[model samples]
Target: MKKKRSIISLCLSALFSLMLLFTSFVKPVNAAPTITLEQTFTATANPDVVGKWSEVERLRVNDTNITQELFITDNEHKTSTIVKGFGNDASPNSQLFLLHKFAGWNTATKPYPVLFVHGAGSDGDFAVDPERNGTTPGLAQSLAADGYAVFAITFAHPHGDNYIQREVLAAAIQRIKDITGKTKVDLIAHSKGNMSSRMYVSDVKKSWGTAFRNDVRRYIQLGAPNGGIDYTFRNTWAAWGIMATGAFGPVPYTYMTIYGWPTDTAYHSIYSAADGGGAYPGQAQMLARWDNVYDLDIFEQDWYTTYYGGWGYYSYSEGIDYAINQGGNLINTLKNTPVKSTVQLATLAGSENVINGVVMEDDGPSDGVVFIASATMTDPMISGGATLLEKKVLPINHVQLAYDPTALTWIKTQLSR
Candidate 1:
């Protein structure tokens, strides 16, 4: 009897402990930290948005093949250049390449070079296929070849708003800045890279104070999600959402963004240079605009937001808890999101395979991996990542925004400023 009682007590204690642990890492409340509702805020997207946005398909023969070839001439006005890079992959033995372009190489009044942050699931390498119709290899390389130095940045793994990936991105940016002596760099980040770029720059300021802010001349985030995204499918949403609301809990870095919905805690705080897709009252207005497939609606249903203390908008369900309970392999829900139905066709419609010189497989969706919403920015610029000038948006995807011809025209207009 005594032994049975002891074992029973032990079992009860263990159960209690597990319960406490789960409760400790609950989801955050849906209330905004700070909110300035622009009752006038309306969607400015066009109806022809369908015509402009392309479809993505799957990969073909050239999609996975690796290559390394030398250039024949010194055509400085090149749009893009591809080479191998450092990273690992899921395949047994796989390798990847890096892409770069030097913009404004010789111009005296050259605008500070802007690094293109491609979307998720893809590196800077366009040698394979263009998941999105707007990835302009010609214009990007030409910008580099023409005089402006341009580089398309890619991480070893997926990192679309996922916590650890952001850290790696921060380190990656620093390394790039170190390699290139250009004092002030202009960043043009797409999709998840936008958030990653913002976090890195913010870290530079926090770690070294505002001194580093000057090192950034201009910062543009294309297809950025100011609010929480469609958290429906992923089990990791609840926990990550909780960590993202505050200054830096799960991500452990500064968040330069504006939440779009009242339910999102980020909507409460406007840490980004621009809030909700328009010019700031202070400076840098008049940027062009872009759009993504879905809004922040998929994950709209309320759950038992643990932090809120009950069944609320940000609750942690058994699904999420099971995924991350008792210290799991912290999955990056942001980057690994499956291809959403809305934008699936557009991501792969037109890409051709470089190898065997035939049409490649349709890419499906993604600049590489991150979704369309996370890559959009409907706002203007402010005083944070350097300069107090007007802001503008270009009708392009995240990566394409940096090097697309139309976007380049808009950038040149900014340069004249």
Candidate 2:
């Protein structure tokens, strides 16, 4: 009986080994790895970003077999060459500027192109490369990678004058329309750039004589001083503190600008020569125009009226009061402007401590330079003209507002919308 049992066990073991061998030779199929979606901002980045602002069919990034190449254009003009990439400032005409265009743009998926407008004393690169240290990828690069046609403009004079900035920006807008072959483009402006964009939107059809106004879809403003920054004239000590540190100095001039002045003095000197040798750009006499955009107080009142030999000068408050009275028309304009929902308008403002790390007014809170109240668009022309979509308040300083990750993420979400 024992011998018979051993034989049976041996036979069973051989049968199991044979079955294992047969299964191994047959080969098993491996399933494809689950594709992971990366979130560019808060949530995971979706390849099928449909029902967004894009007019074209949603894209499947992995479906395409053809490799996408990034192209930088260098279109030559009669005087200067309009090129792609950063650090180019060899334009023959001062007004003629070049914009950095990111290649590998998946227009099929993301159709509407984004045009970034930098703020006062700042250029296009300020949005893409806010730090100026060149260590991290700018917002432009990130947007481009996400499949949107990204373009950045560096004005000849970011802080020169509103009218001139508007003209240059209009030209840039037309150029963008021409290049992308899109009827409209989206604007993401910062600081003084917001002023230029607002002026452009308010008058692009009249000025450019194109459907440029209709072409604009989204007007996203970051740290926009739509009501004008009161701290410029309100807090003298803080203003001087920021000025002494050269906050509005050379690095910005050299970064994304083609015809920017190396120093404030240099620009002021040139302006003085041009202004019939009157005053520097800082003290450059502003024409009395009660607009929601400009610091109207500077023009409406006589700030230099109380200049004594030893008593010094003190008339900012008086000037402010007079300016307020003169700004009645502007106030009326802001309040009465009918809501024309052609372009979607969104504003992002920042507030916290001033540059000196001290909180002065408990009114609302400021992003050092411009107050939160001013940054968020409250004027009628803007809030009424365009469809007011989003008004977010970020906790950051003025200069750092553009570079903040939360602000950038919020911008991305708005663009998606």
Candidate 3:
């Protein structure tokens, strides 16, 4: 009996030894440190600047030192001007990219952190936390309330080059990973913001830019012009209205000749520059005509001349074709570049034509600014390991995709999955 017991005990000991050996071979997950928001705030350089970040405050969260507001300097472009309505500061300092982190990072319950990329003519603050007319919370706020880590980035120029913006995005993702101890993050981009996000994921880069490091787990684009957009060129009258309201940045073509205003040489006109370099390379990158699929808005003044390149009673346009050429015709490049198959992609398009109570783009199905076809296009990302998780069209407008309650709900659902 004693010999039999000894044999059983030896077998148990060997099994225990094998378990330890197996565990040693397995890698340990880098768990997040147990840090509370209060503990994090105690380490802040400027604790007084809570809620909104001042230019000087910095915070140390989870042993990662970060500024309350971070900046990305474009080493390539030494000078850049912010669009009129986006910001007033065009100083050398303002040319740097901007980043924002909403409160409640330490208390986040989500597995992955979310990074918000604002569209053209917008910033991090306005993109995620606009002053809404109703009680519905902004998209970032909603995500934060649900205990999700939320961060946002604003480009140096509202109309900055997409190549530079994509590089900046790579930096932002690395920074978020450093702060949260998460290797991968999810990107939420809107309109033109999708250009840089797609560029990063697709590994479409400039010589100096960083290639895709496979750091993004999921990408959600809202009202993106995936197939490209020619709204301004298709409806020439819209340019006059946009410039008059001072809403969007400079249009690709100058209309001062028609409006009797002095022509601003600094305007981002395709005619004045080669490859759309003088100003607003980002805007130039998002140019593609859908005239083959849909007709130009006939009601718009000089639609024929504006689209076909001619002098009309209302305006003189070099034509949509010329604008696309001068703009680098990046849509072709983007369409050819497939997103890495590993990342999951989803897109949302707004079908509503009214934005901020103004009627726009009534000619076909559009989010006032982006057509449904352009917004929902996923053909470019299918070839690679990238999977199209879903494509949804909501009843919101282009601007509302950032803050509307319905859109926010859909975004939350996607994030949950």
Tens digits of per-residue lDDT, candidate 3, 1-417, equal: 999999999999999999999999996653322222221222155333222422211212232221112112221222121222123343222224545667676568988999899887666665444652324356777888898888877665566668767766787787678778999999999888999999999988766556688899999999999999887677566566655665454444554453676554235453434432245567768889899989877777777887888776656667778777766788989899899988899899999888763447766799998989989889877776688888999998898887788888888888878
**Top-TM-score structure, candidate number:** 3
Error of 2 at 267 (Å): 8.6
Total clashing pairs in model 3: 3
Name the runs in model 2 displaced over 4 angstroms: 1-94, 106-108, 204-212, 238-340, 354-364, 382-385
Q: Which is the winner by lDDT between candidate 1 and candidate 3?
A: 3
lDDT of 3: 0.69
Candidate 2 per-residue C-alpha lDDT over 1-417 given as tens digits, one digit per residue, 9 for 90 to 100: 999999999999999999999998985642211222211111123212211212111111121211221111111111121211112332222243435454543353587988888765455555555675656557776677677888776654434444445555666666667757888888988776775577666652222222234667888887776655443333333333333443431110101111332223222121233322211121122212222433323322122231110111322122332333332323223334433468788888877645445324233466765667666645565554577778888777777666667877888888898
TM-score (C-alpha) between model 1 and the true structure? 0.40
Evaluate residue 300 in candidate 3 and report its C-alpha lDDT on the 0 to 100 scale: 73
Off by over 4 Å in 3: 1-88, 91-95, 132-136, 255-277, 357-359
Q: Scored by Cα lDDT, where does model 1 land?
A: 0.33
Give each model's whole-structure lDDT: 0.33, 0.49, 0.69
lDDT-superior candidate, 1 or 2:
2
* Clashes per candidate, residues 3 or more apart or on different chains: 72, 6, 3
> Residue 335 in candidate 3 has what lDDT?
92
- Look at candidate 1 and tell me the lDDT of residue 353: 15
RMSD of each: 22.0, 24.9, 12.0
